[model samples]
Target: ERLALQALDRADRLGVAGYVLGIARELTGDFAGSMRCYEAALKLLPNHGAVAGDLGRLAFRMDMPEIAAKFFMHYLQARPGDLEGVNNLACALRDLNRCEDAIEVLRPAINEHPAQPLLWNTLGTIMCSLGDGVTAVTFFDETLRLAPEFGKAYHNRAYAKIDLGDVEGALTDCELAISVAESAEDLATMKFGRATILLALGRVAEGWKEYEGRFSADLLEAPRFTIEGERWSPGMDLASKSLMICAEQGLGDEVMFANMLPDVIEALGPQGKLSIAVERRLVPLFQRSFPQITVTPHRTVSYEGRVYRGAPEIEDWSAIDLWTPMGTLLETFRPTVASFPNRLNFLVADPARVEHWRRELENAPTGPKVGLLWKSLKLNGERARQFSPFMLWRPVFETPGVTFVNLQYGDCSEEIALAREEFGVDIWQPPGIDLKQDLDDVAALCCAMDLIVGFSNATTNLGGACGAPIWMLTGASSWTRLGAQTYPWYPQTRCFITSDYNDWDPTMQKVGVALKARFPMA
Candidate 1:
């Protein structure tokens, strides 16, 4: 502690007060403290180009991209020839969701600093984020030309190649990235990327093994559970010991993995206690679904040995096994489509709410009830592949005898208005339906619809769970492995896939044809 204070004093004397403070606060996980320190430093010496650039970086980390853009622009103005500052500004603009502005900002910088590897890498990342993989690949290639050993450039370029349907190119880059990775985390990232690409390419056997790399950290940290005299298998003599199955991921993962519980229990037989750790939101659902097993929320779980002080504690169990609901598990046990579960009677809204919806539908006599899902809850690398609100079901709206109902959340007002003006149809939006308050509202709404059509998202899941006939649209990469017409999880769902990357027109046309065939008037 004394040595740390001496270093802080030295930093203050060296005119690195803000930088030192930011580092200190960040180490303690106080992001707000780091932001304030960085902001103060910038205010003190506004013309310090390096400090301004650092401030921009800190602002971006705080999720204040607009503020970060200002700082970056100031940094660029101070040091007009600074390629790094220019690239940082472009990234800030991109984070602010001004992709065109970001692209325009980088053009002059690229012209001036043509051979700067970092600048080219930044440009590639921005273009990739904006859904222009073709241009991104070009920029990544330029980056590789200047810095051949840059593993990150290779990894990102592989992603762009995958987006553009260049699978072989992506695989080659992945292999190169894996070879250069120094840390376990870096190795895991490259392995995961390669595994994802392999999964996309329908090479499941190799992909599944690489995918197991995800458990490294957890396996290292947690104590392994072993029974004294029992051997674990599908069916073994396990009359005395308990088997713990811990949930290792998200809510959707929990739902997906819950399907595997019956098999786990059947394997363990009636004597062994199958204990599971799951998220709080899933407690009721899991309890209702699997009454036989012992389900504990993660918050309630405890640890022992070198007990980390202030950490929540729970009982130390005899035998623990971690399970994630990855696609590989489904592929292994239920390889055939026939093994898929059909018990999809979701608990929708009350009868009164259904009656209210029925009355509203009855008021509109001429058109078939159509459900619209313009958004999904999950946001990450895969989100770009999910359908945007502006893109889906345009052809379906163009078809006659179809009435579109809005089931989307988050920034959908603009899309709703545009849809109203373009289609000249009053898009039905229900009032006061909070997702948290009414978890099954979408399923309830699907209960009233003649046919449900949307992107492969939560709404699609809801429709499928409600046993509604659904026309689900997916990206080419996703549909290649999952299949073109059917999903094992959702029995009522039929998939329509894009033939090319970022091209939804053909898929939309297929959906239109299916709609017409299924509903003659539509």
Candidate 2:
């Protein structure tokens, strides 16, 4: 890369050297430098269509989809017949949440390049993202017809089948994907995908075993602690050995997986001391909830023996023998549905914060205070499909003798205004609460509420984790097993799922009826 840059600096004949230097820089992961070089090349040769594509891909990788779309459009203008440019342009539009634009870009590409399996596969993926699983299956079938041995197409097809509620078909595609996988990462991804399908189908034993492929997918965030011994596995004697369970994934996942910690402690017996490392925001809650186990933020620790107990800052290796990811707890602790702790209110809110919210809520009209959360922070088509638009919750907001409080994070001031102006329903937004950062106070607020209702998000998980009565409105395909009305992780929570893709009317109607049962109008 350095040599290419030097050569480009020495002589840029017709901007070709600059283009070569940009490619070299991009290959070396110097995205910013590559973009600069690509821009310089494009400035010299305005008609350099390939350079525009390079800049588009670079911008896409850097999460600047708007910039990527501009470059992709420029490239498409120069070479209108370029199928690859069309596919890339579709990707940029898809990333920008313009699925319709993406579809329009690809429809012509499909007609022009009928033999291109990748184009069909890309269309399938985008359709899956858009929650059009049935349509996505058709695209995947087209890809498979063109290239029967394409591993990624099979994998993509499996995801769509899963979303379409065809677990058996998904499993078959997963097997085909695994069979055609060329690389270890591809094989691991197929296995992990199978795990998700299996787990979603409530096949816990095999699902957890296949979930170990997550590490092979190069997706495991480094564990908080360096293990002195082997990773914990089935039939491992935890009674005599202290275990450290490191939290992985999002805040919601950590909260969900920690449900197995109590079982781990009981299995460890009196001789064992289990330590849990979680995100900093959850440390206080975890410490208060599980006093028997040591809870700390993720860190590097040095220790000698079992005696170094000055608030779990450091631990002794002699006492701590085994370490495992929090998700791994499912393997042994929760082998069956019957074995679930089934305990709600595992998480306890700060009494002072709870009291503060309660006092403030008392100032409002006398009614059942309901906490409302609508959208997730994750900006993706899948998440968007799961959300019941603020407008969809209109009928519930109109319920008599029920006061709604805003627990929905992010800037929804306009939506709140619309509710107040159009529907004449006032959803109260509490002052001085940063719904994103101040999670402890959020938990306290949830605890104080008569009930919390929302789509699946971190706030809903946090509220459910705090043992609040949460009515979680979920999409058709949730990562967690939604076979039963209630999730295994949260005992007090009731899940209300949409009957079809993006349909929340039935769920909202059910919530309305349930609300009437709980808080009858005088």
Candidate 3:
């Protein structure tokens, strides 16, 4: 790549040379340099700059979706109604967190070019991202109708079907995708998709086996598990060796996976040592809960002499004999539904903190204190399904002898005020607590509450882990497994789901009635 860049530099053909240099730089992973070279090439070629498409692709790679969208627009202007260009622009918009805009960008193109499978596929992808999986399935079906041989469409359609409670359809799509996959990466993706659907359907043994495909060729850009040691598998006896369970994904996932810590500890016995890698913010909470195991933050310092934010950085890598991702624990510990070691008090909150919150709640009106969360921090497509407007929770708010407390994280002061004005109710925001940062306090707060009612987010997870009485108002589809009214992981966290996608009216009324019965005034 460096030799190619040097050769392109020496060619000195001005416009074309600069464009070739940009491509060479991008190949060598120097995205900033590539952008600069592309900009120089664009200046040299002006109105006839053929590098617009390349620039758009480069910007999209760099996560500058707005800039990518602008470049795609320019490229589309030169060649209007280009199917690939339209799809690229919509994808850029989707990455920018503008799903509606992405849909709008492709909808006109789809009508104009009715036979284009790529347009329908792109629209389906965007709708899936926005959590409208039912609608996304229709779009994906249209794509398949146009291009039956498209393996990517099959892979995407599988996800849409999973969200729509059609596991059989999803499995069929996965089989179709696997059969038509042209590359090793595509094959791995189909396998992983099949694994997720299998897990959701309670086929744990096959799902766990298929899940090994997550680390397949050319799929993960970085090491899936950062711990540089032998990965612990089933049959590897941990009773006499040191084992590390490295955290994967988000905070909620970490907490959910930690439910199996007791099982791991029991498996290891008295002689073995157990260590865990979790998010930095969760260190205190995990430490307080599990005093037997060593807890460390999972952050990494990259090879480029720059710290990679949110990547797990193993502090002491020498002592651990075997290491595995926390998610992988489910394969061995919970291979069957009956094997799930359900617990009431797996996570212990600080008693001091619990008392502190208890005293604060004492001054409030004497009633059933409830915590509520309406929105997630990041409003991705699946999360959009979990949302319930403040107005929709009116029945619960109007219930007498109930003191509502705000547990929704992020800047929701405006929402609180709006609820007060519109519903003639006030949700008391607790003083001196950052809901996002303070998991320990959040756990204590959950303990302090009489009940916690919210969507499927971090707060609900925290409460569920703490054994607090929590009623989760969920959407039709959830990775947390919502086929049952009660989750196997957390016995206290009862789930009340909407009958159809985004229809909260019936669910809300059920919750209101439940609340009245649970907290009837004498």
Q: Write the per-residue lDDT of candidate 2 for residues 1-522, one digit (tens) a residue.
A: 667667766886548778888898766655677888899899987888999999898887666789999999999899986888898888888877788889998998788778999899888878877767788899999999999999988998987877666777888999999999976647777888888787777777788877776656232222234545567978777886788887876788888787777778888898888888887778888888899888887643322110111224545656678888778778787765566666986688888999999999998777889988888788765456556766777668768978889998899888899889887988888888999888888889899999998877778888888888988787555657534445777877777776555356777888878778778882
lDDT by residue (11-120, candidate 1, tens digit) is 64333566567667655645566666666666766677777787787677555678889988888889985777778888777766677788898898778778888888
Candidate 3 lDDT, 74-163, residue by residue in tens: 888887877788899999888766888888888888888889999999888888777677888999999999999899999999878876
Best by TM-score: 3
Give the higher-TM-score candidate: 1 or 3.
Answer: 3
RMSD of 1: 5.9
Give each model a TM-score.
0.77, 0.85, 0.89
Task: Determine which window of 10 residues in candidate 2 has minimal summed lDDT.
Answer: 302-311
Q: After superposition, how far is residue 154 of candidate 2 from its true place, in Å?
A: 2.9
TM-score of 3: 0.89
Candidate 3: Cα lDDT at 431: 87
lDDT of each: 0.63, 0.78, 0.78
Native-to-model Cα distance after best TM-score fit, residue 366 in candidate 2, in Å? 2.1
